[model samples]
Target chain A: MPGVKKVGQRTIQFANPPVVMATASIVGPKEGEGPLADCFDKIVQDTYYGEKTWEKAETKMLAEAVEMVIKKAGLQTGDIDYLFAGDLLNQTISANYAARQLAIPFFGLYGACSTMYEGTILASILVDGGFAEKVVAATSSHHNTAERQYRYPTELGSQRPMTAQWTVTGAGAMLIAKEGSGPRITHATVGKVVDQGIKDPNDMGAAMAPAAADTIITHLQDTGRKPEDYDLIVTGDLATVGKALVEKLTQQQNIDLSKNYTDCGILIYDPSQDVHAGGSGCACSAVVTCSYLLEEMIAGKYKRILGVGTGALMSPCSCQQGDSIPGIGHAVVFEMS
Target chain B: MGANEGSLLDKQFQQVKKQAQQQQYQQMAQSVKPKQTWVKNAVAAFLVGGSITAFAQIIQNIFQSAGLAQKEAGTATLMIMVFLGAFFTGLGIYDNLGKFAGAGSIVPITGFANSIVSPALEFKREGFVYGVAAKMFTIAGPVLVYGFVTSVIIGLIAYFFQ
Candidate 1:
């Protein structure tokens, strides 16, 4: 905690807790269709980014999310002072497009799914330290959009395993303000990037679990709290497979979070919803955390919460070339006063 | 009165006879005749088909200049060329061209796009929901979903093993 500065420990109780003011999801109308269908149809519809680039879809979602947040906050575009965002796409098109439309001073960040936390942490810091009066944090993901741009075209037949998390096709945005009305982010424990360099990209959940557990355990240690201290500890986009793996591994580390720990990936997709095992994406964590969990928090359903965002640092090209995947996790704690 | 009735009947009979004569002449003119015009049709098809391929090459050049990777550019070139080829085919020009050019248009990305879209357009007449919707995704859905899932698994394995 030496590098961590305690800025404004008392003067700032977020008049509006960095609450998710609003959220939106822009899925291609062709649900259950292939990537080719979505891209082709989008091109026909004259969508600007429709040429088989996932960057386009991510950008669209980010733009939509920003629009919704601005409207929800009942504020004009000029009212916002800073925009912090990121995504998995190269160059971070989601943040870039959103920045272009919102036209505010921007900071582009990347931590994979942990991007949400990165945005949130930065916003909180800016607000608490009195650097900015109001800041908005947002992130997004798209299955076909990201896949075609990052990997291969949709027409190439490939095999998949059950252990994988479905890259979610959605986006989420949140507004953090210094003096509004919302739940304040009270405490946060930022984690170091941990990489085990696991070789398989398909089983990201398993690969990321150790880092997730490490961050969760470290956050608890630093905050001088136990697993029971927070009502719920949520990890971003660690599917059912990763969730189980994290649970088992944390127990080995003498940290048991079985009952309270859950994954955003598993929660977003109803297995009955036929989303194929669980959800995975930058938005997997962003949307679920902002929309569902924050809604519950606002309703006084959960008091103290620990939100951990996990990321797998493997590119499709590197994976296809047989390179090992490195995983990272970051944790941010939120409390309701 | 008798003279007038006879005259009117005679006029009506002449009119019927004239109509029958014209009908017979029109039938003869409308009859299908086997012409040895295959050579002409074939030549037309070839010229049109060649022009389509040339246009496709132009498009490919443009895309190449725009910084598309070779594979992507090739696919795009194929798509455009095939679509043009299909248009000429519909005009009865491509059939002749096919006989001469011999799969020149049929062998590239243009041909593949034509194959997919032509069937898709045909299916669209069946309705957007069942015909176009169901069949369109049939070819590409599994591939993308597979790529996505496999990548995730690959990412996981890489993380875990490390």
Candidate 2:
């Protein structure tokens, strides 16, 4: 309790804020063709990205992102104290493999799509506690790898339902330092695992919306802030269906989020992209935040922003066994002032 | 909106969320409820199915003329067709044929072999035990169970009647 500030039960207000020094985003061909293509640092035209398998390609992209962010921050790989990485693959092989290549002390996290923010929270905590000078927070997902692992093989050419979201193929990395000239993480709210007995994996947007709504309400309560306090409120990978649901849920709680709310899932893809619900996976929020939001913040577009990373905690086995998908949302407050 | 307000908002949030989700699922199900292409699919199935049966008859006749009994020729012909289906699936030709031929390619015993071998090939990376072996029977398992049970029932009825 030396410097720790615990707000209510699940939220924490940091005494010493950690700065996001620099960030990098890399995506595959399909993601490159999306609406936010120009924001990305590198867009590999081929999904393989000069690798033989899609898994290998994802590892390459993540490693390259880590390298890019470190270089952008004017720091060497040795300057980073720890690497926090995660991915959508089984055992998070992509992030683990990238860590192997980077040779940094690694901490692997599994929060499904919320893993990017989970990494960010851990990295920020380590820096704020004065334990680390710099930490690299990274996460990745490949369309091919996720489809085969969570759904079906690409060659099957199965028909997808309208509820199914397109797993984004990309990697996003951020270099967080103990002190820097950048946006500071002021507060964080770790959400409860909320399950509405949602069994359909295809409709993950619906499954995760409740968790996001719960977190949004709890964050405002713990911080004693209003919805209008922040310029923007972004949720991770809720897509269209979940975005609508969040709006509905928040309205019931008398929290009007209609003016400033948007989802990274909906922002990443174009309407003409035929992505059904919208873009998803760990890379959805990661790439959008690292590329789009960071640049906009630097340009003085937003002063205070709340990014809530939402995740559906269910594996293919868990979904197959008739177990309901449990959802979680973790919120982090970013401020330029 | 008071800070002291306990789980009131949480409960309300869940209730509103559940109703919204129910509505969304119903809408999604309605939107993606597959189109009625039964008549066109039936036509395709009839033509392709008849053609496969004709082809198998020709192969059985050829085997019979090669100096084998009718029963032996039929079994040998079926085995060869199954081998052909499996080989085609491995070469990535069977899926393409399934696209064009629809029910034609799938109605034969070769189609059954394709169903079993295709999943095994798809999940080969998951390893031999959990990936390939476990998933190999996903499509064919129900067929095998139902076929066995139905045959047993029919055999018992025939034996009693006779």
C-alpha DockQ of every model: 0.01, 0.12
- Candidate 2: segments with Cα more than 4 A from true spot: A1-4, B1-118, B124-135, B154-162
lDDT of 2 by residue, B1-111 (tens): 575465788788888998786666446434533354567766766787688778889999999999999999999999988898889888888776675566777778888
Q: How does each model score on TM-score?
A: 0.61, 0.79
The deviation in Å at residue B149 for candidate 2 is 3.6
lDDT string for model 1 (B119-160, tens) is: 344345457889666655444456558979999999999999
- A63-101, model 1: which lDDT tens digit per residue? 777777877789877888898999888778778877887
User: Which pairs of residues have clashing backbones in candidate 2?
Assistant: none
Worst 10 residues of 2 chain A by lDDT: A152-161
Q: What share of the true interface contacts does candidate 1 keep?
A: 0.00
* Each model's fraction of native contacts: 0.00, 0.03
